[model samples]
Target: MKLLKTDGIVIKKVDHSEADRSLTLFTKNFGKININISGIRKSKKRHLNGADLFGVSNFIFYKKEDYYILSSFELNETFFDLRKDLEKLNISFHILEILNSVLVENETRIGLYKLLLNSFRFLDKNNKPIKNYLLLGYFLLLLIQGEGIMFNINDGLYFDIENSIINDLPTFNKLTEIQKIIISNLFDKKINDIVSLDPSVDDAKSIILLLEDYMNYHLNLKINFKEFF
Candidate 1:
């Protein structure tokens, strides 16, 4: 067995036994890996907190054949404030679910992990009516990073979702000038600035749906959660 120590984010956790959990972690060095975390349930207060969904930690584990066994973990950030509101919590889960679905095991995506962590921090700090849109923006950023899409801010060009390029303007009957501006800015603006804009809930939802479809088409993965609203 090869022992390793690294920083990771908890992507998913499932109870395997009375006191053991099967966890999926996205690590800085090792990418995503499945690990068996024992004794969490028995610890109740302490270990349980470190193993929560969206928890970032420094973990010690040992690799054995195909899987990793988690020996110890030090909690970094739980993003606990997200739990204070039900809606925010739901949005956070949606973000994690998308990542869990797309990110492959043993594929290094250190940049994506950093983006997710920063987005979670933004959610915890900011107050915006369209919180889901902010998360959707981060999702779009990840898609752009993974797909190698070009974003041109100065020209106000839109992404040809099918081609994954910023050449053609978006063609949707319902999109207004303001909505187009918002989408353009999404492709160009800084993460913090984009999240601070207060678009109406309906408008935000519409943009998010369109972007989700674009991502689905490019990634060849159906995003069924777009129908949640």
Candidate 2:
């Protein structure tokens, strides 16, 4: 059998056969995959720290009898500090859950992989606050597109971007128009570029909450969108 190597991040790790572990990895070349990591619990083979959650690594695995067995792995970036903080940890977990829900196993999506990696780095950089809603609105917009969900915005005036398209504008018409532009612009941004936007706290909250609602409607996510707010 031929061995394949790719850069991937661990999404899940589960105990198997006492010594062996089963891991789900989101990879650059293969998208998502399940591989058996043998003898990991034995102290001699414990050097593979890439088996932990959010561990990014270069993995070499070979298929045998239609199942994959990991041969070797070298840790790249564990985002360990991001894991230590409660807020960052929770956001990162939600990101993982969103990715797991939308992607299918063994489907190659290099763009999606890059987006996921950059998002992890952004969280780790501590360049911005975790709950202040940096790039999340834009990220969800891209995730919806990546997952092949179809949607259109008509002359549909949206009073609340989360709820529905409404024709009537409230008394704060100018403010509403500006926010509507913000929501629309989210779809046009690259994942990393979205962090540059500076909106008022009130506007940011509404925009983020609304985007979450929009994603919830389309993806039917198992994780609650409200928790991110």
Candidate 3:
């Protein structure tokens, strides 16, 4: 049997055989994978609980046929502070939901993996929920770019959502100037730099909605992100 190790964050978990858990993780070395952890649910160890949703850990696994079974793990960031605020918690879940939706299994997305860690850090450390709303937009913008379906920035003034393009003429789904700017900032600026732009809560929400539509259209994935924020 081959043993493998990676830094991974649990994105989803399912109960199995009463005490075991099937965890879906987005990892640094491997993009997304599913591993089975035995006795974690019933285990009294505090460290084992780190395998819970959104928890980052250094995971060791051994292959059993085509499946990977958990061997041991070292706990990393849980970003537990995000749970202190409802909006922040929701935003974090929203990001994870999108990740679960789009990331291909066994594909290497190191950039997005790093981005997820950074996003969690930003959400956990920052006090402003409004900025987090924009941060969600930033995550989605980069996600779209990472998927290689993002709209062209240099092509034109109006964005065509259906075609994922920018054109001289306006389309039915043309983004407003402010909306365009927000996307640019989210894509180009640092998390701290986004605060200088000072987007209102409403502005952030609107841009996120736009991004949702863009993602749905381009990726053919339905994400009902409205309930989160």
Candidate 2 runs further than 4 Å off: 130-132, 150-179, 190-209, 227-229
194-213, model 2: which lDDT tens digit per residue?
Answer: 34555555665566666555
- Estimate the overall C-alpha local distance difference test score of candidate 2: 0.71
Estimate the Cα RMSD of every predicted model relative to the unseen true structure.
3.1, 4.1, 2.1
Candidate 3 residue 40 Cα shift, in angstroms, is 0.9
Query: Against the unseen true structure, what C-alpha lDDT does each candidate score?
Result: 0.73, 0.71, 0.83
Put down candidate 3 lDDT per residue, 1-229, tens digits, no spaces. Answer: 7789999999999997989899999999988999998889888874865788889999999878878899889898888788777888898889989999898999998999999999999999988877788888888888888888877665455777877776667776566566667777677766566577776788778888878888888889988788775
Per lDDT, the best of the predicted structures is: 3
Q: Which pairs of residues collide in candidate 3?
A: none
Name the lDDT value of residue 220 in candidate 2: 78
Q: For residues 29-145, could you state the per-residue lDDT of candidate 1 as single tens digits?
A: 889888997778887556576787888899999988877888889999887787786767767777777788788899988888788888788777657647656566656665656
Task: Report the candidate with higher lDDT, 2 versus 3.
Answer: 3
Model 1 stretches astray by more than 4 angstroms: 44-46, 149-160, 164-174, 190-198
Better candidate by lDDT, 1 or 2: 1
